[model samples]
Structure formats: structure tokens, C-alpha cells
Target: MRVRELLNYFKPYGFETPDWMIVEEYGLRPDQIIRMDLNTSPYLPQKWLNSLGSRISKLRFNRYPDTTYRELVGEISRYTNVKPEKIIPTNGADEAIDVIVKALIDCGNEAIISSPTYDYFRVSVELQGGRVVSIPRKKNFADNVEGILSSINDKTRLIFLCSPNNPTGNTTSYDDVLNILDKASDVAVVVDEAYYEYCGETFIELTETYDNLIIVRTLSKAFGLAGARVGYIVASKGTIKMLNKTRPPNSLSLASIELAKIALRDYETVSRNVRKIVKERERVKELLSTLPRIYAYPSKANFILFELLEGDAKTLHKKLMEKGIVIRHIELNWVQRYLRVTISLPEHNDRFLKILEKILKEKT
Candidate 1:
């Protein structure tokens, strides 16, 4: 295929309508639209924002950030309880994925993915000219450990797993992860814990035991830093060294680094917001289950995956969009009826539920 044709095959992240388009077409102001598609925190880290605002005046925009990122690494070390040498920060978990794939995946190598999870991992691997073998998850959205292991071969170089997984909001079993690690000892197994703050389960501890294990996490979700784009990788020091060679120098801006440090300093606030979001998640999930013909999957993370039993997901998504409420419509072969919604503030959640119920009732 030509370069343009190959580019057409590339799948980028998320579906979005520009703010200006929404305003012009939907006749809704940007603030009126409730964004439930992107799994971002509705609540801001007010204290961190306040601190960041005060510190922004002190930042030197003209000078570049320290490429070594020692100070930021120290903060992350304290936060993650991992040594600084074992951590390499990236622009976001997305960049961490790209950098790791770039470092470890060469042309013609294969990477195995647990399907119906995040799409970016496959994109990263393919960009490196690596082939992707996707093993579908079980009916319950759990990893198919046997299928994944059987597919591993001399060409397999990486395996990607997401915990409290995107869209599904379910976690991979710890034993399943351990089994994959033991069997595929030569290939790198990257576990993405981007929603860790919501679930509070981690495989970071296993990194000490397994050299091939890599953990990528982001502050974009729970830390309320999506726009700032801060994330990091946790692996053995040797693995970190190899990834560092491919990681771009000064990928994170000075403002982002400083804001992340401030956010880390006030970890208590992040935890408090997490608790609120988790509580709201349960409340929202319960309410969603009460809706007729809708099944809301049990979620450990801050978002919930909902399956519509009767209606078309695309039609429902369009209806929600017309009403200025946006949630993701799952497009996988096995889950065409599924839609994922991020847990927002209580009022916003109530609004979404009300609007959604009305839409379903109207269809009936």
C-alpha cells in the first residue's frame, strides 16, 4: 500500500466534534456539553490548580526544561514508591507506549494485544512496523490468558494489557498477569494502569521481580491533568535505560512538570477526589442498571460500560450528541451495542441519566 493508504489504516484515539462545530451545529455552548466519552475527571484539582496558578509566574518559558527531569522523577519516586532510576516520564501514557514500542519493537516483530481494550497500543506497534496479533478477551471482558500465551512466538516482542480497562471498566486478574509474565519471560509485558487511582490495584510491585514487566500510568485521568499531558513508566532499571534511549528529551513542558510536582505534593486531594468519584460511580451504575433493556457492567474504574439490549448504539449515541451529551459507542464486532460513559459530577451524572432514560422511553 502507498503511504497515504497506510495512513488511512492508522486508527487515532477518540472521536470528537470540535467546540466551534458543536456551537455552530448543535447551538450549544462548549460549557453546556457534558463530555462523557473521554474518561476524564469532571472535578478539577482546585488546590493544585491554585498552586499552579501562583507558580506559573515563576516559570521561565524561554528556557527549556531539564532533559534529565531529576526533580520531577524525585516527586514521582515519592508518589509511586519506586526508585527514580526505574522511572522514565513521558508526555502521557500514550507517549510512554510509543516510546516503549519504538525501543523494543523492530520491523517484522509481533506484539500481542488483549482485544477490545485500548486501540493506541496497536497503533504504536504498527507505527514501528511491527505486526499485531490481537487475542479477544473473554465474555466478561477478562484477558484470555491461554489464547494470548499460545499465540506468543519467536517474533512476539511485546504484550499489552490494561487494568480497569478502557471502555469495559474491568481489570485483568493478577494471576492471569503473573501467568503471562512467567510464560512470556522473554517478551515485554506492558500493563497500563492509567485508571489506577480509581481502582487502587497495581502491578508496580511485580516490576521488581520481573525484568520484562513494564507499567505505564498517567495523571490525565485521576490527577485532572489531561491537558497537561503527564505520565510515566515503571520498569526495571535496565528496561528503563533502554526505553530512555528512545524517549524524547524534554517531552514534558516546564509548566506541566511544575504542575505535576505540585499535584504530587498534595496527593491527599487527589485521593479525596478519587473517593468521591468512586462513590458516584456506584451510584451511577446502580441507577443505570435500573433502566430497562440496559445492562451496566460492574466497574472498578470511574467509568461504566453500558449495553443496550434493544436499540442501536449509533442511533443512541447520535441522540445523546444532539442533546449535547457525548458518550462512546463501542464499535467492536462483539460489542456493537455497548456505550461507555465517564462518571462526572453528581448533577451531570443525574442529567445524563435523566436524558438517557427519556431517550429510551421515547423510543419505547
Candidate 2:
């Protein structure tokens, strides 16, 4: 028998796994390809880039990183306005999801998820041999708060929600999350604010009032540090203490921790970039609306989700790929015919719109 029979494994989460070789695959130079699939910042702040040299010395790579991650926690505390003891530094938001699952989920138990928000939350719960009770969102990808509450039962151990959800580019109402928090007693509720900087609203303030609330965030989006892989969890001190045990020692590299600290030092730069991205996102939505048979949905994050009202999204995705432009083609039942594109630099955005117009014109 195969070893697969003795153990369980599933394929990893599927986002546009960036292939650098896409440059040669499409017969384009490195600079010609526009990576709009991942909602990462198109421009890395020069201030942060310049500080990487001096900051490199701060990490003691010769030795293992501090298990407690004291310095990183201190920096994060100042940045996020959360106390040091209440924070747990993670390798990425992905790690925080897994750690929370491991901490709360027992084998054969259940976790509640608002569907199509973030896939990894489902993956994390399933990997622990727990059942995922997926409550589908309504049209335009809005959450059904009552459905979520009714789904929670005695076996329910965790509930996960993502604000400014991935792939769909919409923020769940904060009041709905508060409603869940008030109702779901004895169950851990995780509100992932990974795109918090883009939207500028948070449930972090409620962490003090609710003991079971967990807020996870990452530096990958607006901070322009996706490559560094740094994220953190903000919860009450006791909850943080429990998660600390589940986390492996020195899980975050010294370089990553130091680089994150440097990146956080300049909020003004981050804010300026966020403003530009929001502006460009609106411009893209406006342009998409002007196109024949396309509907651009309102977005709070740095990406815009639009539907091809008449054509196949997969076909359009391939056409854009031919032009060396990459974006997310979401094929979920709720978002059928939908596509999501990151708000990129001005020239990249212009190029995408120009080619898209040509493709639709050809189809007509």
C-alpha cells in the first residue's frame, strides 16, 4: 500500500502562485510583466528599502532568533497599539491561522466559516481533522450573520471571518462581527484583518471587551513586505499565552523580524501609498464600468472585483495572459464570471485597461 494510506495530506492553498518564469513563458522581459494577481504593493517605499542595509546588522543570524521574539513584539506593540504580552509574532498570517486551529480544534470537532472569505481558514480547520461548516455568503459576497450564528453548535470550536476578504475585495460589516462575538460564547472567533491598512477599520478595540476575540494581521499587503513573511496575532494575554505554546520556537527568521520593524517605522510612507492605491482602484472600477457588459463592484481594498457580464472570465484571463498581464480569475459559484485585479502602478493599470478594451472589442 502507498504511504498516502497511512497518513493524510491535501494540496496546498491555490492563489496565483507567482511564477517568475512567467516572464520567459510569455516572451516578455522581466520588466514587462505586470503581477496584478497578488494584492501586493506595486511600489516598495524607498525609505524602507534604503534602511535594509543598516537594519541588516541588527539581526544576529549567527545565533538562533529569540524564542520570545521580544524586540519584534515590542515594535509591533507600538505600531498596532496592542500590549506586548497580548501579541504573538507569527511567520505569516497563514501560520497564525494554523496555530489558532491547533490551539482550539480537537479532532472530530467543528469550526464555522463564512464561505469564500479566505480558503486557508477552511484548510487549517480541515487539516486538524475538524469539520468545516461553510456558510455561503449572499450576492455581491455579503455575509449572512444569522446563518453563521445558527451554524454554531456544541462541537463548534472556532469561527473565522476575513475583513476586506480576499478574491472578492469586500469588507464584512464590523457590526456583524460584533454580533457574532456577542453571541458565540465559549467559541473562539477570529477576525482576520490582513488588509486592515487598506480599509482603516479594525475590531482590535473590541479585543479588550471580548475574551474570545482574535484579530490577525499581516505586513504583506499595504506595507509592501510580502516577501518577508511576517504577521502577528492580537488577543488577550491569556489567549496569547496559549498560542505561544503551539508556535514553534524561532519560527520567524531574524532577518524577517528586523525587516518588519524597519518597515513599520514609516507609517507616513505606508499611508501615502495606500491613498494612491485606493485612488487607482476607483479609477479602474470607473473604467471597467464604461466597458461593454462588465460590472465593477465597489471595493475597499487595493484590488477590484469585476464581472464579465457577457463573456467567459476564463477566456478573458487567457487573453490577458497573452498580453503578459496576470490577474485573479475567481471561479466560485457566488462570483461566477468574476475577476479580480490588483491596483498596480499607473502605467501598468493603463496597459491592462487598453488591452482589455481591445480583447472585448475583438469578441464583439
Candidate 3:
């Protein structure tokens, strides 16, 4: 289909939102709802909140930020151990994806992505009037590297790899990434490391070796800065220069940049929080496993994806909602009967486990 024709039928990606109507029907306040759907950090301690709020007043909200975002780039460069010239600060990882798509994709061009992964990659590509070539992941939710590599042709301009993939909560293998990089030498390989802090494995160093590699990172996940919307792209100097052309000027707010700087400076604190989440994730996974009907998949990310063996996923989702809890019931064409819940504070985790166990038991 032509780009203009496709625009008429285009469906913008809709982000998940809590069912406020359900919340009202249950007679519960918004604050009372235990949010385990979004893969964001649990409530921050007061000290962390204070730290994030400390310098907001100093930032000139009335004035435009440095369009180049030089200071933020320097901080990100220091944090990621990449040179400053190779980094481009973005509003969020989503924007980073959009910028990459904008720079590389033209009408009728193509971008390859693995199925049951983040939808934004597909959206970004399609928005640029580029076609999305989706390759299904392996049975275990690993990227079908061979399929992806084979699908690449002259028209393929971008390949998005979301490590520690969302909803599925799995990482792409290092060797598999290298294999693709070796094969698709001409195509831009975009490695999204949004969840890198959860799992220490990374393809960042590969960027130095392969000029076609673009590594996208964000403070959203482990750093608990989702609202701040700060992410950066790491690529070769030439690639960064090209992406900068399409990146929106002053896309990041001064407040976000300041918060990101604070986040990078307080790496120790973020690390501590990440460790706690990882520990909690294991505990939650074990607890979920005890439920005979739910098969929780192994995950390195902050969330768990599981299949409902007996009960209807939508029913379970509704039950959880009535009980003032929220988690994602994943609905996609290639996958079914799956749900995901973010790992949260121990008490919150315990509540969800207790409620879920009760619901599944009653179903039996």
C-alpha cells in the first residue's frame, strides 16, 4: 500500500491506562489501587524523592533548554562510558526510537523487528511511512536471529532489538546480536537497552566495533525516572551526526535533563534500588510458580510474564481489578493467554500473590 493510502487506516499505538470506571465500581480510590501493570519502579523513599525534587526550582522553566543538550550528553557519556560525540539525548527511549526511524526510514523502506516485543518500534517505523517486517520470536521468546538476518534485503534500513524485552521479559543473546551485526553489515542495528540495568548484559561495547550499531538506553527503568522522560542514543560519531539531524530540537525539558543528571550522579542509590527489585523479582517469581495453573516465565526484567493454564486471562484481569490491583493481560495475534505484572515492594508483591493465589484457587 502507498504511504498516503496507509495513513487513512493507520492506528496510532495506544498506551495502557487503568480502568477508572472499574476502580469506581469497586469503590476504591486511585491511590488504593496497587499498580503492578506498568514496568516502573515502586514508590521511592522520601530521601530519593527529595533528591529528585531538590533543584527543580533552580531550573529556568521559562527559558528554553540548550537545544544541543550538551551537559546532559556529557553526563550520559560519563555514565555509559561512551564518548560524548557518540551520544544524543532524547526525551525518552520512545523518542530515541522515533528519531532513529525518522533518520533512516523513508517511504516504502522497511524495518525489521521481532514479534511480541515493544510495539513502539513498529509504530515508529510505520509513522515514517516505512513498512514493518515482524519476525516471530522463538518458542522461548528469544529473538529468531536467523529469521531476522535472512529477512534483511536492500530495503531493510533498521533492525530493532529490545533487550530484556518488555511483557515477555527476556534478553537477546550476545552471540545472536553479534551474528546479526556480522550478517547485516549494511543495515542499522538498533539495540534498545531500556532494561539493561535490570540485567547487566549489554551490546554497548559492540558499538565501538560496528559503525552500524546504535545502542539506546534510558533512565526510565532502573533509575525510576519514567516521568522525567530522559533517554539517550549511543552510536558511532557518524551515525549520531545523522540522527541528530532528525531529532527534535530541545525535545527534553530542562527539568528532565536536571533530573537525569541527578540520577546519573547518584548511581549508587539507583544500583541499590535495582538490587532490591531484582531480589524481590526472584521472590515474586517463586511465589507465582507455586500457583499450579500459572506458568511464570523466567525474566531478567522487573516484570514477570506468565500463561494462564485454566482460567481466562481477561477474567483474571477483571478479578484483579475488582480487588483494586492492576496488571497487564497481554493480547497479541501471535500470543495468547498471557499476563504480566511488575515486581514491586515486598508488601505490594505479597498482596498481589495473596490475591492471585485466592483467585486461581477458586477457579479450580
TM-score to true structure, per model: 0.96, 0.95, 0.95
Overall lDDT per candidate, in order of appearance:
0.91, 0.86, 0.88
Q: What lDDT tens digits, residue by residue, belong to model 3 across residues 83-183? A: 99999999889999999998999999999998888889988898889999999888888899989988999899999999999868899999999999999
How many residue pairs collide in each prediction?
0, 0, 0
Q: Point out the higher-scoring one by TM-score: 1 or 3.
A: 1
Residue pairs whose backbone atoms clash in candidate 3 = none
Measured with C-alpha atoms, the lDDT of residue 163 in candidate 2 is 89
lDDT of 1: 0.91
lDDT of 1 at 242: 89
How high a TM-score does candidate 1 get?
Answer: 0.96
Off by over 4 Å in 1: 1-5
TM-score of 3: 0.95
